[model samples]
Target: MREIVIGGAQMGPIQKADTREEVVDRMIALLQQAKGAGCDLVVFPELCLTTFFPRWYMEDQAEVDQWFEREMPNAATAPLFAAAREAQIAISFGYAELTPEGRHFNTSILTDRDGNIVGKYRKTHLPGHSEFDHDRAFQHLEKRYFEPGDTGFQVWRNMDAIMGMCICNDRRWPETYRVMGLQGVELVMLGYNTPSVNSQDSVEGLEKRLYHSELSMTSAAYQNATWVVGVAKAGDEDGHPLMGGSMIVDPNGYVMARAETEGDELIVHACDMDACSFGKSTIFDFARHRRIEHYGLICSQTGVVLPD
Candidate 1:
């Protein structure tokens, strides 16, 4: 079976004060490290190019524009792509994109070794409310700043493995991973910018953050018999703390690699594509095990209430 080394480029916080060039430079640095370690694909954090802006309430168009990337290989980020071409390495990075059509999306892009665009994933699960809540300690304004993504969850064949992509809150939903898993995905990649504090909900922010991270990835990987790489834009950003539990889980629901203490870090693992073959042949074999024909009754209206 073909094996590939993938890296999770865990970045700390990024501020509005940081320029596009500066942030891309940090990404390039991680790519260089991934290269030195003989890696083919490297994954970066969500909105790696800017601060977690949704934390504060902002109405100015120009101010919000500064936090977005208008072009993928534009001047500020050209160097990162150029370095990728030179190094002959592929990368998947997440950011806020402002399309020429004026649509804003939370996107993750896949690039080939020669810096050619492969595919893109717009976030599916848009969390929080568009309107402001006066009672919450902080705001999760993703639904306010961005529209729901049009592209559905997708899996692509790359580097001899069936791969898929997602971003941030998408990882928390089982349907998100199941959609891709149904496509026979061998690997799934995602990046997030989750906070350490919950603003609206009553759950303890730090604990839920970590729990969701591991639980979502492990369950997805094991249930689907695939590999999941979940990277984070962690640490304190603009005074809001982030949970730093970037991790890589295998087909057996075991964590293969994990972050130590946050900051700029990389976790590299030699993922054997063969292991997934054995897994798919057993518990996760869709052709034999998945009972899609009997799923409609899951939401069917029954006369009897559920027993206590």
Candidate 2:
């Protein structure tokens, strides 16, 4: 059946005062729990290692850089990798990456069962503004802190299936899934730290925000005929709240499992990769269904064009 038991580890929050060492300890505990639950793979939320730093505006470059990791599996995160290797489980998580060339990105990495990093995805669709927006209820300076990801959506062959990744705001964009879907992806993993309330719309509450998150993932899963796992770093981070609707969806767009709380929770499900075949071969067969010639405008333009 090519079945894989996956675990979505939804973390509550990581306050600014939290250390990487402390965060890794929390992650290891989740990994241990996943192992006990017989999970072959575990997925953690975007910026899993620290508080969503983009929510704050920092003027000092050194202070900003402190939130970024110059290297993966560095001193602070080595133990988490070791624990995953010891448990023989695959894992995926997101963090702020600082390149040697002085570039920064919101990045995620995928590891194999033996704990070898096989794939890395930098978040392409960054949300929020770069400058201080007096209009916003709170700051979300992602554009100020990170460069838009250069790596296009790409898939890898792992766990005996074609897998792909995106992060946070990328999930809301259809192109993110379509690109990976075109490559015959069978599984997609993504993570987010979305606010419980929309910054721009004060009327939009937690329930509506969660609904949109699930709708995006579920619709994408069905359209692409792939299994999708979305994990969230939820609950109050300091005083700001992040919503939690972490879930695992089947190829048919069914919610196989979901987290019950906005805490450090693990939702597990046994998914058959082969289940993707029926839809892919039928309705979603790109080769048979897509008319690329009529879709040029998708790549040709960024904004809406009015009729002449």
Please state every model's RMSD to the true fold in angstroms: 2.7, 0.6
The ten-residue window of minimal lDDT in model 2 covers 204-213
lDDT of 2 at 301: 98
lDDT of 1 by residue, 1-308 (tens): 68888899999878768888888888988889999999888889888888888887788878777777888978988899999889888888888899999998999998878898888999989888777789888888898888788889888887788889999889878878788878988889999998887887756768776987799889989988889999999888778888889998898889999998768999999898778887788877888877878887644853567779
- Tens-digit lDDT string for candidate 2 (192-220): 99999889999999889999999999999
TM-score of each: 0.94, 0.99
Clashes of 1: 0
Clashing pairs in 1: none
Which pairs clash in model 2?
none
